[model samples]
Target chain A: MLAAGLLALSAGSSAATDGYAAIDGGTFRSVLPAGPGIEQVDVAPFRLAKTPVTNAQFLAFVQKHPQWRRDRVAGLFADQSYLQSWANPVVPGAGAPADAPVVQVSWFAASAYCESVEARLPTWYEWEYAAAADETRTDARSDPAFRARMLSWYARTADTPAAVGKGPVNAYGVFDLHALVWEWVSDFNALMVSTDSRDQGEDPDLLKFCGAGAITMQDKENYAVLMRIAMLSSLQGAYTTANLGFRCARDGDEP
Target chain B: MRSIRRLLRAMAASCLAVTFSVTAQDLPDDSVYQLQVPLRTQADTASTLDRWRGHPVLVSMFYASCGYVCPLLIRSTQKLDRDLDAAVRRNLRVILVSFDPDHDTPEVLAALSAKHGIDDTRWMLARAEAGDVRKLAAVLGIQYRKLPDGGFNHATIISLLGPDGRVLATTSNPSHPEAEFVAALRATAVASKTPAAP
Candidate 1:
């Protein structure tokens, strides 16, 4: 009970300030292949939201942009389950705590929200680079304890996600990147093209893809990140799920 | 002879322009035309995605420099066009939007159109800004990524949109057109002409 009270207090303070953290992005080795013969990806420095957008923030967004409201949104941009957890169109109510991260939002709806704030959804490379850090080290992906903790989170299923900012902050001072929810990246659809089809001379799926080659996983042991890629690739732009949410990123240092 | 051909193309373009302006306001919520993306055609004319709104549109994305599957995409689309009834074919429009907008200028697109022998009246090679291109690809469920070598790894799926810009069908295997997709195209084209028939 004391921990819950402390969390609520921290959440309220952070919600009032809702700032961004500057990430000095450099070349990072990713699990997903960047391109043909490309292993390491160069991500430009950007500002990422310190925490996921919460229910209270999203509710305010819908109130201002009526076109993005659940009842008024175009069918092409959101599915039937968009914001379904909310008590009503304008209220988050009990089932959705205002401090908890907002889920059940389609990629288009998330993109629109970020655009409203003068930001955009982070690209896959940017998201991965930011998430690779831990509380102490810039790149804790090589640490066995860190990998194990992330894998355990993937194994456990929670009925409701805890409030944002309750988890440990990474080296970049970002929170809830792993233990909270899967995020919607801007280029989610571009992640899973099969690169092996290029060498397989008679590959039947050749017509389905064009140009240089397909993508191959560079780091197979990073199953947690690989799972995120698999999940994102399987989803369409208009799809919404209970455990999927997003955060915003800016192009340069001007957070 | 060249002047006559240019005049015919101009006449067709004007007709399409009139049709688009008339129906621009009442687009359905699910219509792909709801996306306000500006396009530049191979003929150097400014256009939008809804330029051929009242006609059945065969839409796909490709880069002009692709040596292998992109060419097959055009050939397959041409083959599909050949198989359609002449009445349905007349009302069908094909727009292949380029993924590499920086390199695919009007001159490059025009050269590609000439190489493919594409009819300017019914076929258009268009390019949009990089951001708009991504949005279009997302709507059509097409996937593409730019390689370091300047070539794009992209999906070769061809989507058939009805008169209202709703995706009626999509076929990934463009080399051998799916029978169901062909039938859907025929039905949509015939149905679109029904309200206008006397």
Candidate 2:
């Protein structure tokens, strides 16, 4: 109860209500290959939000930056379905609660919201790194229990709306990393994988790509994380969906 | 003398205002020009996508150092240019923006332009800020990812834009201009020639 009271007090003062948790960066093996025969990549230290941005916080953002409001935002920056769940341009009353994680937000809108609070969206690597943790262990993808929990959450439909911070905190003190809503990363467009991307040299059209080749998955066994990458790769930046929301990340370890 | 200079400045500002209002009048709400990307062209001049707004344009993204498909990308557009009649060709502009802006500096872009015999009058090779590059690619529906080898894996797509920045059509097969893409180009050319309703 005391912790809850303290959290509310913090929420009233700044954007960091649940607060930001510091994650020590190090070399981590990712499901996606960095290069041929390279499965591990280095990550730098960063602070991440404890929970996803909620409807109430986003409503405040839209009110302050009217240009981001659904009616006023440029079509080039956001699509037709942006903020579709909202009852009005500014209110989240139609089934969306103030405490619920904001959904139906485009990448641009999400980035803008992060900017308003002096932070930015987490990159694909940062998100992947933080999400690999469970409550007790920093990297828990190896544990059967963790994988089972993730699979169960993945099975749940978004029909039952999600309220932010309802899930258990992970080892890094982050909440709702999974089993809630998929997120928007700052480098969302960088995951340019095609259906046959695994066959890199098949396309004769040399002008198509200027680099090594299309990215192929490294750890095929990690289906849960791979699914996230696949969904993110398929979306355009202007697209918004009912089950997509985001959180912010900042450089360094200052709370 | 100072008063006269101030008066000249005022006159120049008014003329600029008039030009902006005229260009802004007909732009569509969803036009890609709504994005304010700071671009640097091959000639090292600062510009934006809308600089070519008054003409029909063939737009694509590429890097100067791209080994394979990028050359074909140029050839495909050149083929389209070759197929067009002289009049339509003159009215059309071709823009190839670089996805690897860090490596594709103005000097490199200029050298590539010179080697390809790209007429600066009709074609522009350009690069933009990294953030702007992402936003531009987003608006154009192009996808790209930088590889660890300092190369990029990207989608090969060429888009056709009307006079006011509306995307008329796009195709992954730039080497072979589809009949529909050609027809859209023709329509855009005709529209460009016609005066505004006002």
Candidate 3:
């Protein structure tokens, strides 16, 4: 993401809450990128959930809504493969509580939950920052610090489902960001496409994310920046990972 | 002088207003609007988006191992970078997030970022939690299905997010032209700085 002003901007539809994000002008200027459609997502400072959405919270939503429950709303989530595993209740009971984060949800389902609560998903950047934050830490489980913390957290508890406990939060005061289950974000396809809101009228040839052909490069440390951008982009919207879960964000009293 | 200040502010506001389309009213039932996607922390992750919170961003998605779509996507990204207004480019940061966390190792991601002359400053490759991946795909209106080959058969969609991580607009694949991205950059160029609270 790049740094910009706090002014309101409109790309296409003018229906939701909007705000300006920032970027590191110097860093952004120093490097070159793959072919160009990209969005510099601004991740403003805000409260992030301590842990991944748990089964309990999901159960609560299902219980109250009834419509969102697995039995009630069939075929509303991930591909059948993902659905199948979750199809059988891993947990004995179905009703979930509000304190736990929701699980077994697809991005599609998470998004709907956020919307119903009048909140939105965090951009991957924001989620990552909250989940694993070290001026130097980038990804989770891989980072020694992150991994160590996760191991310790897990060590204290059994593999069985559990609620988050009181613990130190990140620099931003987000709870259980790293040790808990993975949290969902809004910008998953950070590497694959070139997207722009300002240049709606520009020619069509410049967009980068529309599907690039192939990329083969090796050398590691020397290319971390490029790699970072591309890695985020490489993801698709259909992915389903057991570790992944989600949280939501909301604009100040705008609705 | 007052008029000039107003002009500058107006120009900046207009820039944001022109590019930032999301409002509280637009976002409703966020759940089930699209497919159920999953996300995981990438093996090799990049810098934080917090670094770019206040700037316009150009983004793309691709796996390092992709034989075709990934390459084309990088090429397009390069073309857009080359074509962006110098001013917009100065204020812009372009990043790539990978979908394949398992294979997109830090080394693989770095090499992929570099193969196309991408440097760390502006361009990058990061990982996503499966949940985050799904939510992002939905917001951008992108869809994909895993292929038997351990790859994905996903639509190509280009997206722009305001400094605040809000979706500005998108360009679907098979039709992304370079000029569109440049225009997106321009839309965000004049806004006042959304510098992270120091």
Candidate 4:
């Protein structure tokens, strides 16, 4: 019995789901608004990619050539080629590590990959929970220093994206959420503070969107944040880039 | 029983929306409007496009009605803004060219910025005519279509324009965290003489 138990323990370690680094923070409990769209997403403690997706991982998606990849036939501009380039498979000769996060993938490509793996991309709130990695402990939402440091990587020589945990993952099992490639969230289009579509009579369904975790109490504060989410949401799967990447998530049991 | 039925209905609806939100490729890119505008920008207003000479520009296209993707586009631009220092911020500016020409006026943009408190002074929201909007979209290989309900079925193309206004990097979804814009900006900055004004 002891021998069998030991063997099982070792196997569990090998298959252990690593990636969650729960931040040392609070139980920010709140209720979702009672509306048609808002719903509670009890994101049980989970793990996420601490860093942005990488070129190597994206290369693999290119081989798969999922529906997201649009072709770059000559003379015609490659529409969002970066997202699909990996989906397009550059040399096919290039070898990629399966464990590496996929970069240059649009929210569509990333979402599809997560679905293929029997998972899903995280909500913007969940991504933040992981990215904040417990930094929700601090009250520095407007720290200019933090924002500056996040962007500092752009000025450096990113010959190869540094390995995960090169610096650190936050409280959540996620690492490099702040400094590496921009990550794609499941509700990557959902913005917290404001909505531009509501201003223009684009659709009566303007406020009625899919993938909202909550009917947020207040509008989001920054167009900057709205802009980021918009960019992520607008992309097709065929896109990829040196800096764009994505992480994965599984809907954990309700917390 | 009625409450349970309502719950089930909401669940079904949420699933359907999530399905389309996560899985669909049908978002508008408006490639139909290819290169029809003069492709002017706020940068052009402050100085000649020649200031950067051959530097590259990262451009974001959006309309006011798009409560969903438009915010994402702005967020992506903000992400690019987040990566820049004050000096680089000065050299690299994210262009927000309004597509909801019917709604996104200069005053509207200024109000939105004031409302949202978007910081990067380098980020400018340009107001233009719908025809010019189509032309600019064409030149940069961006796509957008006016929706039947007045919403747009638009291409979410964010391009890195060479300072000479040559298109450099065209990012798909041009709205996410803007990794393409960030990378293209860095690459363009390195590849330019003066680099465009902040």
Candidate 5:
């Protein structure tokens, strides 16, 4: 009985360390066009969690903030599938390990979790800059081998559940950016590329954007990055999915 | 039996009183007003999003410098007002908050208000802090980004909020008002005017 209780309790509380590593930000070429004259995007220095927040950590959070529990969370903040994988509101079901990265969470829930820790979600530029690194070099986009590895992960079926810290850490000590799951960025909605269909001979929704028209994607060949952008832009704030999780970032310059 | 009936009436009256005095603690868990962020109106007054809590509101996000779509958005809102009966329209208010606070200051908002001939009595042009802007947009489901030309690319949506500050309906069809959306607005307007039953 004691062993069973220990196991159940283990799935609710793990190490409290948020594992934040400071990232040095600079001007970098991004696949998304940096508004006209700006040739490169400039990211400010910030600290990112070395790994995505875990199921155990989130369970503890939900237990503490009952308003965020799946059963009690307001419809304005989350959809029906929010926390659908959990057996109960406070416990992860079978096949869900304590150390596995938490998935099926809405942007609001993720933001609240970050706030509870006095942190925030990483902006798109900051996340992209951090993920550009490999095990050795900081900017590994020119490396064909690095690109191939990232593409292979995308090519594979994402049905397999991911556990945190299993993959090799990058040069900045950040882990599982590409291989684990699609992470939520703070400006997910800001990636609007216009999908209004009324004006187009093609699918009207495809061209239905307001303002200066559809954002011209820069590096079209970078399907990996473009796919992430498409996925992020398509979702609303209250949406959640099986293969989407998030990590937290802080506004600090510490390396 | 008469005493029992009188006691129930008294209990119901107390419930009505409790609802009327909606303290901060009484705000619904799902209320958009729970955001608790400050906003400045074109009148140079500081208020939160829930200031219009006692009335139904049509809320959207826009920037003052937006040349094309914003004008259409304003025209659409005006059209919505025209579609409603005078009685229903009287209880309704329109709020257009700016996503670009850096450019859309109170002075800029006031200028746009004049340029558009916005009826200040029913319509408000407001700006919130940058941090609050994101939270407001998230609640309203409006997405926007600053462009290289100092312009913005955004999705256009207008949401209808009931008196308690919960979203009653939303419409992305700014140029053409949907019949169902207008009906929801009319219903909310009528509902707001009705006295609380005790």
Candidate 6:
């Protein structure tokens, strides 16, 4: 009976590893409002990879699922530049170091990799909630110093992304949420919409967006987070950028 | 009873075999139908994005409870249908998949189809799982976000797909359907009627 129970536990917790850290979630006040009259989003507890997915990890994924290889992937799922940094279809050499976060990846490719590991891309709210922390405090967005540090990273351009886990861990014990690469969220397309038609009053663009008003920015001063939202919203599923990468998340209580 | 169960099992196995063969043989690598998403139509029938594979199709995403613009989307499609020649119309299909699958059940989709007065023979209203809905929207380049009021904010886009499921053209202006899009639809429909060129 004990052996059978152990087998079931191992099956249920496939991605259980030291690399994944538990994030205790709660009401998070994101820069973008959840919707009309909804200022705070209720995020559920989940596990997030301690660092961004590395080139080596993604190399393993493509080796297993040849359809997702840089050459074999369909044009409908990824653009031509997808995995352009890799040395070859199966090799992540030189420019794409094994320890470096995988860049030039489309949302579809990133999601497929996460699914291969029995995980999924974190939702926008979950990412924001986890990213809102510093080394000391969980909700450190109010701190000018924290905001300044994050802004500095955005302003600095680098030819290649630094290795993951090079920065300090956050209050949630997760690293490189900000200072690494711009990550992909599952609902990247759902981030922004034009302002409500009712507010504009007989605007010609009303027909463009249907139903309730679009999401309005709550914290206008939070430019770092706002820029991330802008970049993500502008991307399509098949688009791949030079610095775009992703990490995986799992649902249910962290074990 | 034993014979009936065995017969049902055999039928199910044959259906699975047919599905696998279609997916493996005919689908193009870049076709939106490459997405293996299952959908349910207004008639409570299981369907897929490739149901009208051999014919030109007009596809869009909308929520059944959408108050204002969704109805306009339906009218725009109907106008496009009316603009086409009867012969071309007979060869074209219209599919509107719901972004809000939780509330837009098969029954709700059927009601919306009736309310719009669409010809069920050529027009299909369908709903897919939430994850599949997102994937379909991404492939169609449609954007949608759910509001706190349970209503969705979404783009109004109708895409024209060739007989092979590759996107041919798209129009976002529901108020005024583009003549170019109509012409493209007619061209694709007429082309589909002809035998393949060597």
The C-alpha lDDT values of all candidates are: 0.82, 0.79, 0.48, 0.48, 0.78, 0.81
| Tens-place lDDT digits, model 3, residues A92-208 | 243333334454466655665665555677765455445444334323324555555554654454344445533454444355554555555665543332333233234444433
- The residue-by-residue lDDT of candidate 6 on A1-255, one tens digit each, is 999889877643233223678888799888878777778888988988888998988998776666677766667788999999988989988999887899999988888888777788899999999999999998999999999999998998988768877788898888889998999999998986444435523664356677665676778788899999989999999999999999999985644
lDDT ranking of the models: 1, 6, 2, 5, 3, 4
Interface RMSD, all models, one decimal each? 12.2, 10.7, 15.7, 19.1, 9.9, 10.4
TM-score of each: 0.88, 0.87, 0.39, 0.39, 0.82, 0.88
Q: What is the lDDT of residue A83 in candidate 1?
A: 92
4 or 5, which is superior by DockQ? 5
State the lDDT of candidate 5 residue by residue for A15-51, as single tens digits. 3234798888788988766664355888888899999
Runs in model 2 deviating more than 4 A are A1-19, A194-203, A206-208, A253-255, B1-26, B194-198
Report the lDDT tens digits of candidate 2 across residue range A4-45.
889777665344337688889988988776665567877899
lDDT by residue for model 6 (B1-198), tens: 223333334445644221111243245666877676799999999998889988899999988888877887888779878877766787889999998989999999988888889898899999998878888898899888988788888887888888888888889875566788767877874588654333
Error of 3 at A182 (Å): 1.8
Task: Show pairs that collide, candidate 2.
Answer: A206-B68, A206-B69, A207-B68, A207-B69, A207-B70, A208-B69, A211-B152
Our model 5 lands, by Cα RMSD against the true structure, at 7.7
Candidate that would win on DockQ: 6
Which residue segments of model 3 deviate by more than 4 Å?
A1-42, A74-76, A81-101, A132-158, A191-239, A252-255, B1-198
Candidate 1 TM-score, true structure as reference: 0.88
Q: TM-score of chain A for each candidate?
A: 0.91, 0.91, 0.54, 0.56, 0.86, 0.89
Which residue ranges in model 4 land beyond 4 Å of their true spot? A1-46, A50-101, A134-148, A151-160, A192-227, A233-242, B1-198
Error of 5 at A164 (Å): 1.1
lDDT of 6: 0.81
lDDT of 2: 0.79
